[model samples]
Target chain A: MAMEAYQAQFAAHLPKAGPAWLADLRQAAAARFSAAGLPDRKVEEWRYTNLKPVQEQLFALDTAPVGDTPPALLQDSHRLVFSNGVLQGSADDLPDGVRLAGMAETMAENPGLLAGHMGKLAQGQELPLPALNQALSRDGYVLAIDPGISVSRPIEILFLSDGGASYPRNLILAGAGAQATVVEHYLGLGGGGYFINAVTEVEAAAGAKLQRYKIQQDASGSSHIATLAGQLQDGARLENFDLNLGGQLVRSEIHMALQGVGAEAALNGVYLLRGKQHCDNAIQMDHAVGATNSQQDYRGILDDHAHAVFQGKITVRPDAQGIEGHQLNKTLLLSDEAEIDSKPELQILADDVKCSHGATAGELDETGLFYLRSRGIPEDEARQLLMTAFISETLAKIDSDAVRGIMERLVGEWMAA
Target chain B: MLEIKGLHADVDGKEILKGIDLSIGEGEVHAIMGPNGSGKSTLSYVLSGRDGYDVTAGTITYRGRDLSELSIEERAAEGIFLGFQYPVELPGVSSTTFLKTALNAVRRQRGQDELDAVQFMKRLRVHTKALNISDDMLRRGVNVGFSGGEKKRNEILQMALLEPHFAVLDETDSGLDIDALKVVAEGVNALRGPKRSMLVITHYQRLLDYIVPDYVHVLAHGRIARSGGKELALELEEKGYGAFVSGTEAA
Candidate 1:
């Protein structure tokens, strides 16, 4: 009843009419969500995640303008802003071969682009969150890079929500041999009693290189749930990094399908949480073809009563022989009350495949602590140094120096806090 | 100047250093030699303020201040250095960064201006060269992938850079070849001065032969069984630790 109440309120924000196929897609998604409702602890994929707190809040749709437009992650980049749940004015200076537009606006002008990738990757109807996101998404962005074109600057989407709810359905389509970077940044506004359920679908065509970055800094009184479904063609590469620094309750699920030979996916993330925060990250790396690679490296630094969950699975199909997949999850527990639940599963149906998974959680190294403090470094500084060292292994994977520097500064701020 | 009066300490609630008394003035270097399990290393750990080496009953007065009142880093800030028997390997922490942080922290504690990067590197270069250490070694993680000799050399390099007034070398000569021994001994011999004092703890007389001390105290069980001049190490070396080890039965 609570979910239904919010769903009706969110539907009022969408236009009354769209194309027939798009309308049909929404109806089917709505039916699926109504049938499934909210997933409970019984759901195997969400065993470590609890939606009870989310169900009780019954967040409303507040249309008032909230929060300042945060500055661009980079000084020189294409920017898009979505206030509450609606897309604001567009970004300027786009390259000649790039098409970036809001989903609803794009449907009216050019439905052909949204026709192919709107719901192709995330076909699973069992997940209620994505189903609800598809049924209600109206103003998410659509970014398409033409074939053989390369965008020099990153495209940033700032989703600022306050006292309300927002459902953003995003699409990132990379043509053959195309390269671009897309950043989905979520910020909370006005003490943030908001709910954000976002779904992003990515299609990396043959030989395309796509880098996706998600920085979730939702407000302390909000719940941010997001899902990413990506499909890679031949020789395509996917590099994704997530920095989860804020939010009271957050869950990010990533499903990557390596459908093309020579395709690769490297998903790395770091969650630095404190207070009563709860963050869950689930990744399912599917190797559908042979000779593909996938790697998942995540680090969690939890203090106070924070709880973190990392569930990474590498599934190799029977035909996906000669594939290499590895995963590692390490956590640093800075407080006795802090907790972590880590499960790394590997289901390899193919022979001659190389796969490995590792998960470790513990406090800071005592010997290393003494080694630093014994030299005049204070206790807190020494702990911060070790925490930085622990996460540097994951941060080193970021190829962009500017992005890495900014992320490092944010990490420092979190440490100082 | 440092003084230890009626020193009693325990490791894991087991008494190790029992009612030991010793005193050293400025410009003095005292060598504590003993057989295995004589609490030689424990005394050094207690002096450095390492946790778990509890001082049950004693007074460690350094420059007329209680050493127990200060923490490990506080002791280091107050010019106390411990050259460990086995130096820890800290991966992912560069020697330059580690040393710079440490030097600045110590400087801040000592009411001295922090060294700028240029000044820090200049000082780092002087000590690395004096210790026969290469510049590349400082670029790598502190003691990471370092050989046994290199770890000890790094310890001495830290000692030289920190410039502690009272130093404790706990088995600093444990695992070095003759060539490395000479290089390390030369590094230690170079730091000797009338303003600095040292307490060298070793199981063998070979190290005492190099970093020659003004006083040699033979420890048996938990207390100092014998104290003599520099000739006492040679006498113990020739005769072995038979008399000292036997004296510990009643100690």
Candidate 2:
């Protein structure tokens, strides 16, 4: 009865009019999500992170105005704000060669693009949360850059959650030889206990360079489940950076398919959690074609009773020879009660491939602490310095100076807190 | 500036510094020379308030304050510096940041305002230049990937910046070559003044020739078996530490 009640509520909010194809896709996704339900600890991919607390919450669709964006998320760039799955805020002024449109507007104006690329990279079938997101999401953005054009500035997307539940789907497509940077920042407003299920799909054409940064800082009471899936063509480069610094129940899955030769993927992230927070980061990098390179680095700092999970899997297919795949997950448990489950998986079916995965979980280096304390730094300050440095490895991989500086400051503030 | 009486310490439940007594006045530089396993490092660790070096029985009074009553950083705030024999490498903390933090912490503890970035940089430049340390070294992590001589020099640079009243240089010349030893000794000599005292711990007299100590004490079997002027270091070097290492002294 509870499931039926929730399903009826979701059905009431479905898009009234859309293309027949999209409607069918949404219906199929809803069926898939309803049949599977929430993933439990028994799921192999989500064995370490439990989602019962999130599933038990009765989250209705939210259609209210989210408050002003945080100053930290407001940088000098083309900004898009999506509040409660509704496109709002400033996106009027556009660059000369960049195109930005809401998913609904894009589908209505140019249905051919959506018909060709929508749901191609991320099908929402690999996991239940993404499927649920696909069924419930009402509005998102469609960003596309023209061929051979380089957008000099970053395009910032701010996702603000007001209350209840919101499902947002974003699609980024860079044409051949086009270069651009995009930032997806998630922020929670008011007393947040809502569930945010978001999915972002990206496609990079040949010789295109795309950098996407995702920052998830939800309210302590909120639950955030997000999936980022991208495909790279020949000679295409993709750099994805995710920073998880909030949310009580959070699981972020990033999947990339290197579909063509010379395609490169660099997926990196840093998660800092304290209190009873639980954050899980899963990365799947597939070298489907030959001569591809992929690097995955994720780090976590857990304090108090916080728990962190990092599962990074790199798969090199039979035709993916001459591939170089590297994945490393390092975690620092600040408190004795803190926990970490780091699983680095390497599936290699190809010959002449170089693949390595390493996972390390440990406390603060004692020698480093003593070195700092002996120089008159107090114990707490010393620990903070060490932890900051540990997280800096991931921060340093960020390509943008402004974003890196902001992230560094946020890390410092979190440490002091 | 520093006095120790009946100082007994243990490492992992094994006694190291046994009934050691020593004293150093203002402007004094005391050198404790001994061979391996003579408790030279244990004594330095005990004096610097390093954890796990339990002071089972003793009192270390520095400027009339009981050193045992202070934490490691508290002792550092009280103007006690210990130059580690094996300087630690802090991988991600730059040497410049380390020096600035240490200086500002000590200054703040002494009721002084923290130095701004410019002020700290200006002050650090003075010490780094005087210690023959390069600017590039300051930008790298503290002692990380540094040569043995560079590690020793960095330690002296910290000593110069902190300007402690009583410094214990535990084998400052252990890993240094001839030129590095000379440069490090010059840094120490420059810091010598009426308000400051130092304890130079070494096994050979090679270092004493450079930064000449005011008083030389031979530490054998965890106790001072001999005490004299700096010449005692040369005598022990000539005779070797055989007598001292055997738990019997020819003092």
- What's the TM-score of each model vs. the native? 0.96, 0.95
Chain B TM-scores, listed for every candidate in order, come to 0.97, 0.96
Each candidate's DockQ: 0.74, 0.69
Candidate with top DockQ is: 1
DockQ of 1: 0.74
List, residue by residue over A208-232, the lDDT tens digit for candidate 2: 9998988888888999989998999
lDDT of 1 by residue, B1-251 (tens): 89899999999999999999999889799999998889998998899888889999989999999999999999999999989898888777888899999999999999999999999999998888889888788888889989889999999999999999999999999999988988889999999999899999998899988999999999998999899999999988888888667854322
Error of 2 at A144 (Å): 1.5
Residue pairs clashing, model 2: none
Candidate 2, residue A216: CA error in Å? 1.1
